[model samples]
Target: MKHCRTRLLTACLGLSALTAPAFAQQACAPRYPPPTTIAAMFDMAAVTADTLDALPDVDVVLAARGGQDLSKYGLRHSHLAFLVRNDQGSWDVVHLLNRCKTDHSDLYREGLVNLVGESSITTDLRVGVPTPAVRGALKALLAGAAPQARALHEPRYSMLAYPGSTEYQNSNQWILEVTAAAMAQSGDGTVLDDRKRTLDWLKQRGYTPSRMHIGIGKRLGARFFADNVAVTDHPASERISGNYSVVTVESVFDFLHRSGALERELSIPHQTPVPAVTGTASPRQASSP
Candidate 1:
């Protein structure tokens, strides 16, 4: 769901391809969010924090945001991450972020506020509380067994990476793989050693990916112009038809729900301030000590 399409398809492919590299080496320009937007985002972050704080029985949960307009796909949230309860009792976000305009990605650990930064489309936050056993395992995986957790990420990134392939990975795909590995951990401490095993574990659990139908025109455009979208890693049969079984936030959430991995789901709405009356104090001022 990382928007890495910095360059659009120009008039002449030959000239543009030759002059401009396939990928942009530098990160995309920072967006200057309006003050009001920033305030709203902070408000959403605060509400999200409060919601997570209320989940006393959960140590790790899935957090998602509406980063993109995915209504066409019947999806709400466009990105997903794990919120692990830190020693300080605050939650921290762990997720994969693709290097801007590149076919590469890296794991990032940030605070809840950063995860909800500059809200797009919507400021509503989705949280999935895992079953107690699953939560404990995930907490252990991301904390005590962090190296093993980090090893699960495949650096090569693709927007529509196949759910069953290790050639490339999308952000949500990484979470699925890691969750498989976490679930595969045995009481004896044995764990799935690699991505292949994790994928197999997911298959055994009946994990289903979201099937997206990309038209030929859009497929061609992505293939030729987008570095973060690839078809080579996908099954030829599926690729040729322009339908891809890719991992998405909704797909992963459905899988977890079906597998009895998630015990609860909730959405925290963005708390916007009420309009101030002509001579009244703002909400912030009224709430102040």
Candidate 2:
């Protein structure tokens, strides 16, 4: 069984879409139109695809996209996805995206080219490859991702969601929790299927998530109006002492690194060019990673 916890809706709070009023939802809708020129679109897609193609021998991979200016809060990559080769022998980038006009997010399967094209910001990307020890389990998790993802998923989205609490989840939090399912070990190396149990294991093992220092006005306004903004899932001690939780791709990378699951890190350069072709298809080989 899943242990879910949630609190009252808050107002707008996003570095990407922050700085808005209580009813900012109407004003804060994010939109990304298609690139103006075909050449511009090809450049973004080719660079993103080439980056993935460069990772030889990597089967299961974690990737992040930084299209926003999150540097003020010490964030580089704002979004994350798992890259795995699909059965068709082509790589795919799989992740959760919040469905616009709704509070829920569902799994999205995108090619490396589309992944780049979907970016609302710049085309820079980051990738993390796990050690061989964790790769097998990651494969299993990917194979069963749909059912498992749906069962534990909550439609509520919060950028500063509490990791330990089941109340809400951000994009990175979902990745972290799914990783927990892969790394959860009993006496031996078996993983825990129950999400609650996996979470318990993570806490016992000292998996620390990033905590953002939010001020009074931004924090209060977000908590009052936006359903996607939350504060109650955080610990009472943190609230009193003022340590708020915000899950980022960096936090998940840190947790995996601390747990010794990460083997290598790669920084993909957007300036690098790929041979531009009329077709948008990425060569099919294995999967998204």
Candidate 3:
């Protein structure tokens, strides 16, 4: 009777021990919070951008010391400039202007998609040989091919522009003149040589030379805008306006390729690794140290 009682007790203990972890896990397992809505995401980006803009210029520099905080402000305007992951495990942007909204869906298709009509910086250069891996990844994105682990070897591109006005004409002309001067200073031979190459490239692509415009915007304050609106026949024009630090697409690709974001994106697998179980004794450890 004593032996049977002891065995029964031992069995009960074992059963409890076996079931405890399952129970504990059920109690402790994380309940993922509700997914953020598209509107909420856009609001966050706007707040972030506004806060960034409001900070002292020096403070902005400090906050962005090594990474994207600075770049984000420079590259993005009211549009959803940064990327966020959704509950369904996809990356998306929340464009504030409803630029990406379509009748078919409220949530825009995310990841490696392109702006309608024009090729992004990555797609435009991918067909050429001796292309960098980052460039290839960007190309893959523009082509809707796949996400790459590597950073793209290309400068970022944006289609946004300030509203047009003839009042800012002088400011616009100044922007072009500055661009030409910079191109002249940076070229291997003469500014004319580089201009010829650029013009030829544009011509080969069937771009109308007369439609090219370079100008500064009064609305943008001191910034300059360079655009190729004629190529696409867009009435508002496609322009990029910023300080001299901003490089042309060719320069941007060369720099990004050298920086290794492209290679990293390509080589790294998408799935993050599950952490190894820590502090648990293995079967062998249960027997000995």
Candidate 4:
């Protein structure tokens, strides 16, 4: 894995944090200041991008950020996306985002800085290096295969969407399905192009969704107040226990690592009090990944 040293600036700006689309599905309320400043967020993204740029012959990598702190639920990072290198020698983040206060979502292509600054609750950037074959497939699908990538997106958004169901999809679920679509190849060189086929391929490959323990009070609250969260797509047995299975950053990375699809993992930490110098800051391997 490659590493880079980046400086974090402490310039104070009254920059408001953007509302998280699906990662942080809390009750409707007033927004609060993010944990890190905009300058630190940009610096964290720069560190990540520079690390990728330092790698030899790398094109696509899995990047994730921490949005809402779900430590109570045993979760850290909230959302994940693919960072694909473009011809201009820069990276673009491709992921799914729910429309503002709506139950539908759309695919978005933005910069790494925008992704890191989206209501991030932590300063660390988590990245996964996929196997060479998987990286090649993802790079091809995300960079040049626009129509093929669009076909995997399902507009209906649900924070607790089931991995096996097609009724609704969460943000991480779309990335998982697209990953399956990229890896599901045939002898004749055909790949899974639709959600159903990709989902089936995921199941066949033994992909598992993370089970979140949402208590009765929170479940009932989200039932009535949360527009972007839904549990109807989950099976009755799981929903009755107040623990719904949903796709998450940890689950997706675990699947990739256990299935031998990932080659290495790296963690880029950011601290506001650190000196603003381009000194050597080596990223460590994540214990969980």
Candidate 5:
């Protein structure tokens, strides 16, 4: 009779378990506060894509150094899809997302090419003198010989060309040639005169000249002076015939100074006059000699 009672109790318990509601099998409730606008959604997606692109490109295994999972650094299909859409829509990528995951070296190379291309297009559109106002100001300083300053306005055509890997020795010669041609028609005696003066200035600044080939035109025939230590010009081109010159930092600054392209200082701190004092100071006695 006790065994029967026990069996009856077990059966009741099993029945209760079987009849209990299956809360875990129920569907999840929807989350609230959905994204408000299409533009906002696009912005969020673009930002995510940019974040993915900014990840460091170093081999994940090497970067992780045997601790973190390298797989985490590898580009995901989802990330690629996001990047494709962002690139299609955005004009300029402002924010880079993940610095750790992006392949930085490749990105740097690609960025250099794009910037050069855009700059070339913009520079080619502007005609006439490079800096007319500066030229006029210099002419005024020299007293009414402004028309003769036309020599300063001579056209110097610049092409973006790619230099061959072995063309490092040819850059300076090309720059000399172009400068010669550009200054030739200026009635500036000889191109070497200006070149010599420019070279002397550069030397005084502690720059040692080296013969280097910079691919800057339709053909990789342009040459310029480059010091390996003091100057670096990275050459990039889609085709050998379309190579561009990445002007050295020193060269650009020197050019701006020589051509008066540098900006003038505004009023100096002490130069501004104080308002004239209207009220008089206490008068001294006339008897005091």
Candidate 6:
């Protein structure tokens, strides 16, 4: 009887922790700060980009990082960016990021490693390679991506944003929409341009965002405390039904491949295992430890 009672109590405690409102996140709100000037995250991002560049004859590739181990919730790779060397021979990684650790909410483009900054829980990453067609479009759009990102970018940042809405955008969500512009195919079998048109096309073609199970407590607290976090973007039905859907790297990759966009993928250590979906995506594409 005592053992059974103890088990029940433990179960209750676990449930409470999971369901508990972000008392911890609010009271002890984990201060997500930027990396120090002397930090190595900056250099690491460059090194990672160079290493991806080393892939035999692969000049540009889509790189992603989870920063935190959300494997228990199925989001191992949470953020993404395009790594390339421009005509000026300088390596540039164009990506979107929430201007968090600040008073206001906005998006900014910084160094490659700055994406992870001091937020990364680990040093590993998972990389995705576009197909020739996708890559061609990706390369062509590089020059215009900055402005495109700026246009699609909403200063309101939310990790649990509605995938279909432009109200609030996250790091990976912006990339997904921008990439959709490059990879979207229309009814007449022609690729589309313009962010609004491509996103509309994505909706028509059954593109779905990944559902996050962050529970109601964190959702409420996040919105209450963080200016960048918004919970209303998700559908009222989904929120009432307890389904927290947010755009993520996994969803982006899944959607891209489902639409015949992503050509290859590479997963690395110190993170969740890669997807088993068929394609050129490998568990490890000859990456070093």
**Top model by TM-score, which number?**
1
Q: Per-residue lDDT tens digits of candidate 1, residues 69-111? A: 7789888788898887767665667788786669888776665
Give the total clashing residue pairs for model 4. 0
For each candidate, what TM-score against the reference? 0.81, 0.73, 0.19, 0.80, 0.18, 0.68
Deviation in Å, model 2, residue 253 alpha carbon: 1.2
What is the C-alpha local distance difference test score of candidate 1?
Answer: 0.73
lDDT for model 4: 0.73
In model 5, the worst 10-residue window by lDDT is 58-67
Tens digit of per-residue lDDT, candidate 4, span 1-289: 2323322211111121233222223233544344446556666666777778888888888888887677777887888888887676667678887756589887766666657774333547788988888888888777654777778888899988889899999889888887776666422355888888888878877998888889899899999999988999888888899878889998999898888888899887853633345655445544435
- Give per-residue CA lDDT, model 5, range 1-289, as digits (tens): 5334433433332223223221112122322222232222233223322332343331000000011122332311111000111122221211111122221101110111111121221121111121334333332322222233222221221222112221221222233222322333332433332334434433443332222232344132333331221112233233333323332222333444464443421110111123444765455754456
Q: For candidate 4, list the clashing residue pairs, or say none.
A: none
Reference-based lDDT, residue 134, model 5: 38
lDDT of each: 0.73, 0.63, 0.25, 0.73, 0.25, 0.59
Across 1-289, the per-residue lDDT of candidate 2 in tens digits comes to 0101100000001111232211113223555444343334345444444454556766778888865457877887788888777665445666766645244556656555435443423556788888775766777677744565455555577767788887777778777777776665312575565557667887887887787777777777877766666778889877776678766888788888998888888876554333445756565734556
Tens digits of per-residue lDDT, candidate 6, 1-289, equal: 5334433433333223323321111122334333342133444444454455456656557778766567877666767887655554334556655443332234333344444454333646677887766666666666643454456665666766777776767778777876776664222445544546656877887788877676777767775786766678778888787677777778888887787776778754332223345566456874636
Off by over 4 Å in 6: 1-47, 101-107, 116-123, 185-195, 268-289
> How many times do residue backbones clash in model 1?
0
Clashes of each: 0, 29, 18, 0, 28, 1
Query: Global CA lDDT of candidate 5, please?
Result: 0.25
lDDT (tens digit, per residue) of candidate 3 on 237-269? 343432222222223223324432222211111
> Candidate 4, after superposition: displacement of residue 248 in Å?
0.8
Model 3: residues with Cα > 4 Å off, grouped in runs: 1-85, 94-245, 264-289
**Residue 159, candidate 6: how far off, in angstroms?**
2.0
The lDDT, on a scale of 0 to 1, for candidate 6 is 0.59
- Residue 86 C-alpha lDDT in model 5: 18
